[model samples]
Target: MVEGIFHVGEALAAGDVAYLVQAPETLISPFGRDLVAAAEANGTPVYPVSAAVMGAIADKDNPQGLLAVAHTRHVALNSLGPASQPWLVALVAPQDPGNVGSILRAIDAVGASGLLLLDGGVDVYHPAAIRAAMGATFHRPVVAASFAEFAGWARAGGYRVYGTSAHGRADYRAAGYTPPLILLMGSERQGLTAEQTALCDELLRLPMRGRATSLNLAMATGIFLYAIHDALDQQGYFAARAS
Candidate 1:
C-alpha cells in the first residue's frame, strides 16, 4: 500500500497494478489532481472519502489525503547481470525500514543500477519503508539474495566489491571505484562479519573525528553513494549536457 500524494502519484506513474485509491474531497494540490487523472486514465477506481475516513485507512500520522493499494514488484538476484558501468548498492540484514527506504531514495538519486538486499531484512513493501522512500521505491529494481549468493554473483559479473568498515585501511574518498562496482553495507547493530568483510576487494572507511564512533546507516550509505557518484562523474560517467 502506498500513502501520501507523492508516493501514490509515483506508484501510478510507475505503472503499478493499482486496485483502489482513496482521497478526501478537498484535495486541491496539483499532485493530488494528477494522481486522480492518472487513476482515471488507467481505469482504476478512485473513492472520495472524508478526512476522518482517510485517517482511519491511512498509516501516516498526517495523512496526505491520498492512498493507493498496489502490487509490489521484485527482481530476482540471478537475473541481474553486469553492465558496462554498473553501480550497485548491497545491504546485508538492514534492520530499520526507514533506513532501507532512505537508502532506496539515495540509490535512485545517484542513478545506481539497483539495490540488493542480502540475508534477512525489513520488507521493502513495508508501509514505513515505502513512506520513507518518498516514492523512490517505484523508481528502481530491488533484489533479494543471500550473502554467499551475492558474493558469487558479484565475482562472476566482475564487480569490484567495496565494503564499509570502521577498521578499513583505505579512506572512502581515496578509494578507486572501478566500473561495475558494488558498495556493500552491513547491518546497523552488528556490522559485516569477518567472513563477509573478507569477500570484499577493498574495504573503505569514513573517518570519524567526533565522539561518535559511527554514522547512521542511511547517512553513511548516502555519503558513500554521493562520493562514488562524484568520482564517477569526474571520470566522465555521465554524458555532457548540450548547452
Candidate 2:
C-alpha cells in the first residue's frame, strides 16, 4: 500500500484501511506523538498531514499542520464477554460529539467493557467524536442502538441499570457499581425522562460540594467510571482467578 496523507473525515469515511493521527508538538496539539509512534510500532501505519487538515479535525479557528491515517478497526460488543464483567455506559440523546468522545476516553481509562449509545445520540463515527476520543476508540466497544432495544437487552442480560438524575434518592458514590451494571447518562440540557426513568433499577445523584447544580456529561461519566473502578477493585474483581 502506498503512503499518502488524508483528512480525518475522509480517511475514516473510507473505512478500509488503518489510520493514525499525528499532531505537532504544540500546546494546542490534538494528539501526542508518543501515541502515534506506539501505533506504528504495533504495525499500524501512521502519516503526518498538513496543519490545515488537522485544523479541520480539531476545529481550530485557523489551520495548523497535523494529522495521520490508517485502516479503521472493527469491534464487536459480544467479543468482550460472557457478559460476566459487563460494565456499560449508556448515552441517550446526547447531541455533542465532543461529549461522546470524552465519555469514551473515560470508559477506556477505567477498563469498562463496552458502551451502548442510544438513538438520537451523536454519531460515534463522526469525525469530531473520533478526534475527541484521542485514540481510545481503538480499544473500546461502542455500539449504537435505540433506547427501547438496549433497555430490553439490558433486562434480558440481567444488567442492573442505574440512571443519573437530580431527583435520585441515592448518592452516585453509594451505589454498588459491580459487573453486570449499566450506567445511563441522559442529554445535556434535560436530565432523564419519566419513561426512561421508569426503566432504571435505581436512580443516582452526584453530590454537589460547591453548590453547582450538576456536572458536565463527560465529568459525570468520569466520576462514575472511577467509582466503578474503585468498586471493582474493592470486590477483588481485578484479582486473577485460581485454577
Candidate 3:
C-alpha cells in the first residue's frame, strides 16, 4: 500500500488512486456526485485527510482538494517504435518546470519518439512540471544524459542534430528534417552552451517580426516540431505509395 495514496471519488471511478480532502464537494465540482459514487462502488479507496494536512502537500493556489501519489512511470529513450522516421527532442539547461512540461506536451502532440534532457535541465518529476505537462510526461519516452554521451550515441545512430538558437542563420522551416533527427532546445534566459551548441549539425531559429526579440521556449519548440511534421507530411510519410 502506498503511504500517501489518497483516493478521490472520480479518480477512483476512473480506476486510479486519488487523494481526497475533508470536503469532497470541492473535489467533485468538475466530476459530479454520480461519478464519485461509482468510483467508490468500484472499490476505489478514498482516504480523507484534514484540511491542514492536505493543504501542506497540495498545490494551494489551485488545489482541487484532490491528488494521487503513485509510482513514476518510466519510458526508455532509444526505442521510439515503428514510425516513418525517428525524432528525438532534447531539453537542454532548462530550469523552469513549466517550460519543461510544456515542451514534453508539445513533443507528444507532434508524435516525437523520444525526449532527452541534459544534465542541467529541470527535473522531469517535479510537481509543477507534471502539472504543466497535462499528463503527457506519463506517456512520453525520456532519458537523462550528458552532452558527450548523447553526441556519441547520436553520431553512432546517424541522427542529425539541429539545435535551436537566437544566433543561427538557418530558418527551421527551410531545414531538412530527415529520419533519426535530434531537435535540441535551450534554457529560457541563456540558450545553449558553446560545447552543446557546437555538437549540433545545424543551428536553426524561428522567424520573428514582432517587438519581442524571440519566441518563448515552449512555443519555439512547438513551431519546430509542427514544421517537421509538415515537412514529413509533404514527403508522404504514411502514404501507401512509395516516394
- Scored by TM-score, the top model is 1
Which segments of model 2 are wrong by more than 4 Å? 1-66, 69-85, 209-211, 240-243
Instruction: Name the better of 1 and 3 by TM-score.
Output: 1
What is the C-alpha local distance difference test score of each model? 0.86, 0.70, 0.68
TM-score, structure 2 vs. true: 0.73
Q: For model 1, give the RMSD to the true fold.
A: 2.1
lDDT of 1 by residue, 1-243 (tens): 888778887888888846555555657788788778778877987778888887888787867777888887868887787753388999999989999999999998987878899998999999999988888888888998999999888899999999999999899999998868999999888888998999999999999999999999999999999999898888887653211
**Once superposed on the true structure, which residue ranges of model 1 sit more than 4 Å away at CA?**
240-243
Worst 10 residues of 2 by lDDT: 1-10
Clashing pairs in 1: none
Number of clashing pairs per prediction, in order: 0, 11, 5
RMSD of 3: 4.7
The positional error of residue 29 in candidate 3, measured at the CA in angstroms, is 3.6
| Best of the two (1, 2) by lDDT | 1
- The top-ranked prediction according to lDDT is 1
